[model samples]
Target: MDTSSTPRSAVVLGAGIAGLAMARVLHDFFDAVVLVEPHPLPADDRPRGGVPQAHHIHGLTARGLDLMEELFPGLDRELEDAGTPRLDHGRDVLTCFPTGNAPRVDTDLGSRLSSRALMEARIRGRVLALPNVEPRTGLRVTGLVTDAARSAVRAVATDDGGTVPGDLVVDTTGRFSRLPRRLADAGFPTPPTRTIDAGVGYASGLFEAPDQSWLALIQPTVCPDRTRGAYIGKLEGSRWMVTLVGACGDHPPADQEGFRAFADRLDNPVVAAFLAEARPVSPLHRYVRTENHRTDYHRMPAWPDRFLVAGDAVCAFNPLYGQGIGVALEQALLLRSLLAARTGRSTPSGPVGVAGVAELTGLAREFQRRLPRTTGYAWRMSTFQDAIWARHRAGRTTRRDRAVTWYLDRLYRAAAADPATAATFARVFQRAAPPTALLGPRVLLRILRGG
Candidate 1:
């Protein structure tokens, strides 16, 4: 154990899933970990103002579930014991993508269906149990305090005129993070931002799960032709989470009849059929701010040492893709790996060297530089679809990438009719494989011959 190399403390902003995960990761490297939240966290899986989308349907992708299980062993068992519905990606979900319905078959990919609030609560519970972790509630982070040179963050300034000092600060404050503003105020250049707004929105509600063999149903709309979609899935407490989505000026209605009518108008009537017979347990909750945004902190000419941003603060994708939590989990995993390498504590024998600002500066820069690579694929997939609708709505022709687009259309059609193709594409959609897998010789041959 190299106590001299270990940092005294680490501070994390935002007590959501990302924040909690950050705290847990920091616990392995720092002597003390403090998690600050603006609101008091509930002990149970109840809706909170901080996360409006919590009312909507949410699930962990296969990769996300795997990461959670790695970070918190027995996580799947814990959720199952709590009555959460487990979904075998290929067997349990009936998906109707714009291409076609994915064939039903056996798959090794795993997913869990539950409310975001519940997942957050479970993860937070594990983080709070760590002896070195402290959860501070009802305190807003007003700004980050820097040293005289403003080269590194030394502490977090709270709204109550107080400060929490730490050797490292990780900002998981989500899409509305103010770290950029703080940096600008401190005479530092803010990271450049990129956004692709499809003008999409969602209206969600909780209802009793329909009597069906499948655990979930999805009917997504095709671009240019249709702009509405629906999803109905089982959640804990024997209830179902239903979300109706509309894009590019086709917003869903919040009223009972309108919501039902909207669902009925999806590409398929699966969601509408379930809503027809299901009993509503909650009001229609609407969320309109669905946009893909990214802060390019990695490209900044100069970033303060010991300050890092992850989760939604770094990249927020279109919620329709179900990649937010998954991306956040991957980001946390990346951070852990980065920290492990710098500390030389490869098997957790004991605490590694205390990382001073000088030691962490290079790591921070490297992390930001490499962070985009991790999110690039998901961003491309989600934004590509959104851009299709965006161009269609604007009466502009889609930019032609003849080889790629033509090949994908062919592949999608093949997947609808071929079980093997469906499973292969499913892996890409679930992020189990890289997009290049579709370019393999055999798959390309099938598409070339119009299989």
Candidate 2:
């Protein structure tokens, strides 16, 4: 492995967080990296066609913030300068957990609140600044170019009648990617698929936040009878993005009055209060196109060389968990490490060397392994908590449910009073730290002692 050798070239599909992050990491290992996006990405804080969920509220968990900082230093400051609200999770925002109605003690590990569109715009600007990276918008990727043997993909075809060849191709095309279909048409067997439809629906609209007040509250009410949840997140420019979600056939209505009524029914009053006081900045945007879907690409009997899929294209979680962006960032970090490990090794000049292809394939496989543990946890948590609401709706009461709810209630109350408990809970909620930390001996003792 010679460190002085010219780096490889790579192409990334989509310009969303995952795609942009992939391109950013690829720039470090490749002499030329091109990002293909189908929509014209804006230079300022406006919505793009590619990300339909742009109007929705987005926040980085403490762990995600740390990873982003490691990937691009000063991103936090950049976001702050752009008017993103930096929230101390324990102190600034109040969260009501399902375990109990007692408010959790707030801690200091803060989260950044902003619109998904704003964050995407900022990251895109930084990514485009790299000399070795090129982003070409409005070019749709129609298919992949594979060798006659069909064991590997060599290039990607675009609707513009042009081809972009690369040593590696990473798909960050989000949940709507047609790569699996294209691959199946190319004689490749479709990867195994899994779907869990909680029948969730979302309706979001931007509204003006009160002056001098930071609106970073998330009140997730679990209603067993109706199976519904709602969230309110503060965004930049003094606006707030509120979403009303329903599950198991309780879809949120799209109209103005219907939407507000749904918010009024949530266990938490925060969303309804904001809706009554704030003026709407945008029309209600509704999303319910896909359930939680994931493909086991790594477990495939065979895969094309020089091809890998990342981001939502690989596994899309229930957005209510707010894990999509964080997971994507972690994937990019992993991909960067894989490339760095392969740096000095011999590679096939004509196409990705067989060994090089194997390495990349392994990287994609590792992502698959990690997805279940990540998304699966959130999926189960959401459904399980929803089940409690369902039980309440059914007018069923059980000693077990009561006990669990009691413990959770005490935990939240303690969190609101004890900064240590609050910070620990925030870390777990952000997915930046493990949930087991909350069950530690000291924490458990406090919970038993009723804080």
Candidate 3:
């Protein structure tokens, strides 16, 4: 082992939102950070081939936006200045629950309405500006280059006949990542995965719509009866991004006519009305990977040192719940915290090398083990809702799972009309509060009244 090389360095895979955001955190603690991506990242704000779901609506909760602002300060104003609409949830969002419309409860919670492309570009610009960070795009990641003992990954092997070495190797390669397979081949125990799929599919289209009263509209698929959901948000350039979703194998159509026709079947007719008046601007795009799955890396009995996985690579929630970005950013923060925790009682491992590289010895596994603390709330929020609606179940769930989901359904129904209840529900949805926060007596009173 070459102790002189990159004692405080990190190699991050996949430069999408997750990878890019992870790079932002890594650069602050490490000396040299290499961002490896298989696809060519365009300079302009356009969708890259790597993210197929880019064509669909990618949402960020208020908590996620706040996290981004924390990393890249003033990002909120920057996004707004670029024509991204800053939507006040209570005033700008209209949700049509299966039962009725949710009463608008004005609050300070708001987030920018922008395409994934736009958000990625903005974050990329800031991250790439860092002097210690290097963006290596169009490079193929073949596998993890491990130490002689196979106990730690020291670098990333690329098909270009080159390797990017770092003290710590991180994977943020989204849901379809092959890192686990590569690791399994390298003799590490493949972590078990838990999934909850609702047999859901989506068809999305971009339209040039007139200025509307609201910034976003949502009609989610629910249990027992409802199978359709819709979300249409005002993006930059006066373009509205519309995504129609269906559960229980009731997939939405990909064709333009079918896309428009499917909207008419939603619980909320507002989506249909908007579609009828708006002019289509892009080809209809279809996506079906909406399962809530988590690779239980934390629970893995044996984990290598100096290697970590974050973002969707660890846990991908149902996009319908809009938990991906927030959870990803939270995970990055967790990484930062874990790194900071080890800063004390650690000395330099090598001269003229990466800073804090000595602490990297055991931080990777510690970070992985603590990740559930951040992901559990978001994972349950999405999967529990899907339990009521998912047609294709991934694994066996206990009776308590069903019981918890039913209680959530009641809370949603009560939130439809009760402002106080809705506010608390919104807090939980935005990642501002935990799900248990809704179990308060006030929320219970509202639910009983609605019943």
**TM-score leaderboard ranking:** 1, 3, 2
TM-score of model number 3:
0.92
Best-fitting candidate, measured by TM-score? 1
Q: Residue 280 error for model 1, in Å?
A: 0.4
Shift in Å, residue 221, candidate 1:
2.3
How many clashes in each candidate? 4, 20, 1
- TM-score, prediction 1: 0.93
For model 3, give the 10-residue run with minimal summed lDDT.
345-354
Task: Report the lDDT tens digits of candidate 2 across residue range 1-451.
Answer: 1223435568999999999988888777667888999899887888888677886768887777878887777989989998988987766775655443334444557668888877888899989998888888889999999888986677899999999887788998998889889888888888998765556678888887675333466665443344567677777777777788776567788788898787777756555556668888788888876367777787788777778797889887767777788778887877766666665432212123223343454554454455455455555544445445445545675777777667766676676566677777777777656777878886788889885
Query: lDDT by residue for model 1 over 293-405, one digit each (tens)?
Result: 89999888988888889988899888878888877777887888888887766644233335654446576777778888778888987887787666666776445633444
Model 2: per-residue Cα lDDT at residue 380: 55
Error of 2 at 18 (Å): 0.4
Q: Per-prediction TM-score, please?
A: 0.93, 0.83, 0.92
Q: Model 1 Cα displacement at 301 (Å)?
A: 0.6
